[model samples]
Target: MRTKVSKGKMAKLLSVVDRTWRAAGFKIVQARPKLPSLSAAAPDGCIVKFSVGGFGQVRFDAGVGAISPGRGFHVEGEEGDTFPKAPNGGPDYTPDVQDRYWSK
Candidate 1:
């Protein structure tokens, strides 16, 4: 889900996610998704999910200044343990479609 993060704050937000994911040498790739028919997203930019060197996958959704749990425990890790979230919450990221075409 996306939490109205300003374009300026994108970097700061990434920094938070990057800290945890980067430590594990993982790359964050953005995807513009069109799945489940009406679920077209690219909605204010969101970090959906990524592979963990074959261990499993971790799901994510970007918030203003925090990251709330997407699921109790997704493919790899729990979303809450993975990010610092804002007191307010936001929308869920797009459906998990592996056909990722990378974006900055």
Candidate 2:
């Protein structure tokens, strides 16, 4: 899908995402606007895709999506995959806990 936001705005959004994730101690390999496919049946929407090294990729819809101010954006990750288990044997979603585990 084409993004409602301009290219400059999208770049700023991705920069903020990269900075925020890095500040929280997560390694971001790449974060950018995904290119549209050449096939005739390809979806018409655009997505901001990001990859966390050794973990997985995440896609965020570019239309009407905001990266800040109360979690306005939508994100989707790969299915049937799991992040590193937490210390209490649950999923590790917190930045502090994830940093600890990923640091090892």
Runs off by more than 4 Å, candidate 2:
1-3, 31-104
lDDT accuracy of residue 80 in candidate 2: 47
Instruction: Kindly report which residue stretches of model 1 are placed more than 4 angstroms away from their true locations once superposed.
Output: 24-104
Q: To one decimal, what is the Cα RMSD in angstroms of model 2 from the true structure?
A: 16.2
**Across residues 34-65, which tens digit of lDDT does each residue of candidate 2 receive?**
43111111132333334222222223423333
Q: Per-residue lDDT of 1-104 in model 1, one digit per residue for the tens? A: 22333334344444555556556554445422211111112334433442221212223433332356564445655444223343466533423323222212
Per-model TM-score versus the true fold: 0.26, 0.29
Model 1 error, position 103 (Å): 22
Q: List the residue pairs that clash in candidate 2.
A: 1-44, 1-45, 1-46
Q: Would you list the clashing residue pairs of candidate 1?
A: 1-91, 1-92, 1-93, 66-84, 66-85, 66-86, 67-84, 67-85
Per-prediction backbone clash count = 8, 3
**TM-score result, candidate 1:** 0.26
